[model samples]
Target: MKTLLLALLLLPIAAIGDDSRQLVKLPPAAQESLRQEMLDNLVAVNEVLTLMAEGKVKEAGEAAETKLGMAAMGKHRGKPVDARPGPHMPPAMHGIGMDGHRAVSEFAAVAKTGDRDKALALLPNLTSACVGCHFSYRTR
Candidate 1:
């Protein structure tokens, strides 16, 4: 009985981190597009990390800048959310997106300077922004 009660109490906590299509409530096409964008971003991040691992710091930084920086926003503009028939993102969600890009841009700048230690340290903070957003928002 004690263990069962404990499990029940922790259930919502577990679900909090597993939020899915419940928060954003977008159309199917828009949701899929968003998911695809997320996958693409993940791929870009992986490529940047690979380059960094190979000691190609400049190239890695360039990759991060091109893939996740301000330049990348142009490609996403009017495509992911604006031109697509969907509701506007809540301000909190919008802020999360901007914050994430800023973190990546800062990381790219650090990597560009060949400061491996500082760049690596920043990666965790960038990742934390991603995880926090995931935990706090979801799209259907």
Candidate 2:
């Protein structure tokens, strides 16, 4: 059973075949910045989930909007960022990234209204945008 579970977990990585995904060639600095941003985005999503669980809808919305939504574009620590990753990305990948940000912004709007259920329902859409981009592109 443990082996089966391990294999199930590994399946997605195996499925993300190098040949199938587009390789995004970025400057080393830009690549590292992108990696950090992605990690931060994951953490922000988790934070939002935790806030939602605590019925802190306003806080969750603020976190989402400031961390992963449109408000986050070209900014880190609420300061304007110097590294611009979009210019290095292919147009399709850039669009996917924008869509993901937009989705988060939309979810934040609903979350700010304190309609937890409505906001939660939109979570999948934002996550789907993330998943789609990860599945289709790689920066390695």
Candidate 3:
């Protein structure tokens, strides 16, 4: 049983694979902006995890909502200017980013309710998006 649970827990990470090389080069300013965004995301994820560890599930969810949620990003960054995909971001890649944002939103909702089991269950799935995105895209 323990083995099965552990395997399930690891499944998402395992599926991420090792393909996360940076695939595109951006202008220096864009590259630095993206790097900072990634770092901020890392901090948010770490904060949520720490809150969860401390048994503050709802608080963790709030952190996710405020830090990594789609609405939050949209609010801070403004709505995307172009409906068409950008130069480096193809339609498929953009779709992946959208999906990742949605996953983060979903995780935040689950966490907000203080459902520890469900939140724990979704953590790996949530992180898989990050792994998949990093593996699939990068800036030079």
Q: Assess every candidate by TM-score.
A: 0.75, 0.80, 0.73
**What digit string (tens of lDDT, one per residue) describes model 3 on residues 11-119?**
4665576744547765555555556777888998899899999999999888887877776554324423332123346555556566667777888899999999999
- Per-residue lDDT for 1-140 in model 2, tens only? 23223333444775764556668888776677788888998898899989988999888989999988899886533432335577788876777777778878999999989898998887664575676777667887
Best of the two (2, 3) by TM-score? 2
Instruction: Give the local distance difference test score of model 1.
Output: 0.67
Q: Candidate 3, 123: how far from true, in Å?
A: 1.1
- Give the winner by lDDT: 2
Give me the runs in candidate 3 sitting further than 4 Å from their true place: 1-22, 75-88
Model 3: how far residue 14 lies from native, Å: 12
lDDT of candidate model 3 versus the reference: 0.67
RMSD for each of the candidates: 7.9, 7.8, 6.8
Kindly report which residue pairs in candidate 2 clash with one another: none
The residue-by-residue lDDT of candidate 1 on 47-110, one tens digit each, is 9879978988878778888888655664545675543422466765666666667767888898
Candidates in order have lDDT scores of 0.67, 0.75, 0.67
Off by over 4 Å in 2: 1-19, 76-82
Instruction: Give the higher-TM-score candidate: 1 or 3.
Output: 1
lDDT of 2 at 22: 66
Clashing pairs in 3: 20-135
